[model samples]
Target: MATQLDLQEQEQLDALKAFWKRYGNLVTWLLIAALAAYAGWNGWNYWQRDQALKASAMYDELDRAAAAGDADKTARIFGDLKDRYPGTAYAEQGGLAAAKVQFEKGQVDAAKASLTWVAANAAEDEYRTVARLRLAAVLAAAKQFDQALAELDAAKAAGFEALVADRRGDVLAAAGREAEARAAYEAAYKAMDDSVDYKRLIEAKLTALGAAPAPAAPAASGAAS
Candidate 1:
């Protein structure tokens, strides 16, 4: 009985060794890969948090400069903010604020440059649309009518469709295209929501332009072509 027990124990030990020999290297490499990935993920999270904190502080400085109407300081600080933290929402907001300050100071060219940058580079589509709208207004004021219309045509933000049409009417009217201006104003009036105060302003524009709003379609049929 004792000899039989010893033989059985030796067989079990040999089987365990064979299992380790077959899988030991694979297990070791898999564990190393998992640990490496975990460390990398943690490092990336820390890096993003650090970047955002620094960007927030810089944005606050830019905001203060803009509020104080310090165009030069606003421009300088915005330059730094955009260069160092272009990926942050702070950079986009700073660009818009800087543009507003410069525009108020009659630095039209500089304002255009800042607004163009935001239109091209903002991470959010809504910000891009706002930049484009402001840029179009500036271009129109400069009598660059075709360029203003081009900018408006390129703005595809859904909620801004009415505003874009309204701006287009203004540009077309400035260019002495009266028929097209009336049509554009009508389109703007139709696009605006009924409850918006701005819609009433749009209606007033249509009234002044001698363009009547399109009659509303029945509710069951919704909007008609």
Candidate 2:
């Protein structure tokens, strides 16, 4: 019985060795792959954190330059920020901030370029929408009516449909397309919520276009008992 037990144990050990010989390289490679992936994930997270810290500091500098009304410095800092950390929210905010300063300083072309970059490359849909809206306004002011309308067309964001329509109306009005302008204003007015103060502005636009939304009809009186 002792000899039989030892033989069984040896057979088990030999079977385990055969299995290892057949699958050892595959198991080793799989473990190496998993470890490499985990390390890469950790490295990527660390790099992103480092980038955000640097971008935040750069954005602070950009904000100061913009606040001081130094359009040139603002543009320069924003350009550097964008080049180094274009994926960061700070870069998007810096672009928008720099554009405002540039626009205020009558650097219309520079402003457009900044806005265009944000419109094209911003990570968030809302930022891109805002950039396009501002770009449209700038283009309209420059009498680039077609380009303005095109920008407005591309400014689609979930909650910004009314604003886009309103901007479209403004661009059409600028281009002397009164009919299209009135239609766009009416659409904007209809889409805006009654509780929004900006809706009142849209109403005013419709009124200006002589297409004021009709007053809600009075509810029918209940039949007399």
Candidate 3:
């Protein structure tokens, strides 16, 4: 019985050895691949965190420059942030913030350049839409009506159609296209929810264009019991 048990154990050991001989290299390679992937993931995460920290610091500096009303400094810091960490949210926010300062300081061309970069390169759709909308306003102010309209045409983000329509109306009105402007305003008014206070502003725009929406009819009075 002892001899029989030993023979069985030896057979089991031999079978394990044969399996290892056949699959050892494959198992080793799979383990190495998994470990390499895990390391790569950890490295990527660390890099992203490092980038965000640096970008946050730069954005704070940009904010200080903007607050001091130093458009040139704001633009310079924003440019550095964008160049070094374009993938960070700080870069996009800095672009928008820098453009606002530049525009307020009458640096229209610089503002336009910053907005154009954000419009073309912001990772978030909403940021891109905002950049395009602001760029259109700048273009319209410059009397570049066709380019303003083109920018509006490109501001097509989900949930922003109404705003795009409203801005289009403003651009058309600036361009002396009253009829088209009125139509765009009407579309914007119709798209807005009744509860939205912004709808009233759109309504005022429509009224200014001689296209005020009709007031809802009053509910019929009920007879007293």
Candidate 4:
């Protein structure tokens, strides 16, 4: 019986060897591929985190430059950040910050360029909307009324409807189109929550234009910026 058990164990061992002989190379290659894929996935995740960390640091530098009011330095570092890490949220944020500095420094064209980048490529929808609104404001300040109007009209988010209307009113008022301005102001008034002090301002705007302010409704939070 011991000899029989020994033979059974040896037979099992021999069968396993035969199976390995038949499929060992395929199994080994599959295991290697799986390990390589796992390693690649880990490497990619690490690289992404490393990139985000680097981008955050660069953005901090950009913020410092902005605080110092060095438009040139801010622009250069912002450009570097955008170019090197365009996909990072920090890059879009840097664009917004740099645009503000450029605008305050009276660099309209530079600010427009930065804002355009943020509008076009920002990863966050909120950032894109803010950039669009700011860009429209700048264009309106430059008296590019049609261009500003086009930007506002093309904006897809309903969240900024009131702000867009308010901006449109400003643009129309700048162009001395009082009737259109009144209409726009009314729209803004209607869109705003009645509780906001800004609604009173809009109402005053309508009164100045000799147009009755639209009846107040519950304010939707649709103001951009």
Candidate 5:
């Protein structure tokens, strides 16, 4: 009986040896490849996480600089953020923030540069829209009416049609094209939400251009600024 059990064990061991001899190299390589892939995936995730944390910290610093109204500091931090992390959301936010701060601080050229980068490079359409809109504002303020109108004309982002029309009206008004200004204002009035109080501001713009304001009245959160 013992001899029979020994024979059975030896037979099983020989079968396993044969299987290993046939498939060992393939199995070993497959296991190695799988481990390498898993390690690479983990490494990639860690890199992404590290990038996000860095971007967040830089954005926080930018926000602080903005709160202090230090245009030079804001510009420098934003420049670094854009240079190193242009692919991050924080970089886009930094551009917008820099543009706003620079514009307010009377740095028109710098403001335009920041807005232009956002207009051209922003990953999101809405950010591009806002950048174009604000860039038009800056240009219009400088009385570069044609350029301002061109920017607005090129803006096709969803949900920004009203804003674009409104800005177009401003540009036309500045250019002394009252008729076109009125038409643009009317378009803006129609495109905007009737329940939105900002419509009233658009109406006022129309009225100023000798056109009646929108019939439905609502309040405003922000208007053109």
Candidate 6:
């Protein structure tokens, strides 16, 4: 019985060795490739996190300079952030902060330039929308009417549609395009929720333009154009 058991054990060992000989090299290479890929992914994640941390620190410095009312420092720090980390959210935030500081200092051209950079290069969609809106406002104030309208027209955020329309109305009114201005004001007024205070302001604008709001339609059987 002992001899029989030894023979059975030897047979099993031989079978295992034969199986390994057939597939061992391929399995070994596959495992090595998988381990290499996992290590590469981890390295990339670590690199991205390190870059983001550094970008965030630079943004904090830019914010501090702006808070202290040092436009020159803000500008220099923001430029550094943009150059090193243009794809980081922190860089876009710095651009907005720099533009605000510049605007406060009556540097309209500089503010516009910063906003334009953010609008074009922001890594986040929301930040890009904000930059475009602020840039449009500055252009409107500068009486760059066509450029302001083009900016507003290119802005496509549903949440910002009403505000863009209102600003467009303002620009049109300034340009003495009374009819287009009235239409834009009407669109803004209709888009705003009834309970919003800004709705009242838009209504006032319509009133001032000698453009009365259209009467409410009956609940049923809506009129066709």
The C-alpha lDDT values of all candidates are: 0.90, 0.95, 0.95, 0.90, 0.91, 0.90
Best by TM-score: 3
RMSD, one per candidate, in order: 4.9, 2.0, 1.7, 6.7, 7.3, 4.9
User: Which one wins by TM-score: 1 or 6?
Assistant: 1
TM-score attained by model 5: 0.81
Q: List candidate 3 stretches off by more than 4 Å.
A: 1-8, 219-225
Better of 2 and 5 by TM-score: 2
Q: Looking at candidate 2, what is the lDDT of residue 60? A: 100
Candidate 3 lDDT by residue in tens digits, 1-225: 579889999999999999999999999999999999999999999999999999999999999999999999999999999999999899999999999999999999999999999999999999999999999999999999999999998997999988999999999999999999999998998888888899999999989888889998999999999
Model 1 Cα lDDT, one tens digit per residue, 44-156:
99988898999999989999999999999999999999999998898899999999999999999989999999999999988999898999988988999999999888888
**Model 4: which ten-residue window has the lowest total lDDT?**
210-219
* Model 2 regions lying over 4 Å from their true place: 1-9, 218-225
Pairwise TM-score winner, candidates 1 and 4: 1
Candidate 3's TM-score reads 0.94
Name the runs in model 1 displaced over 4 angstroms: 1-19, 214-225
lDDT of 5 by residue, 1-225 (tens): 579889999999999999999999999999999999999999999988898799999999999999899999999999999999888888999999999999999999999999999989998998988999999999999999988988887788998999899899888988899999999989999999979999899988877767786365556668675
Q: Which candidate do you rate higher for lDDT, 2 or 6?
A: 2
State in Å the error of residue 17, model 2.
Answer: 1.1
Enumerate clash totals for all models, in the order shown: 0, 0, 0, 2, 2, 0
User: TM-scores for all candidates?
Assistant: 0.85, 0.92, 0.94, 0.79, 0.81, 0.83
Candidate 6 per-residue lDDT over residues 1-225, each given as its tens digit: 579889999999999999899999999999999999999999999999999999999899999999999988999999999999998899899999999999999989889989999998886777888898899888988989999989888777668878889988999998899999999999999888877899889988999999878666767965787
- For residue 11, give model 2's deviation from the true position in Å: 3.9
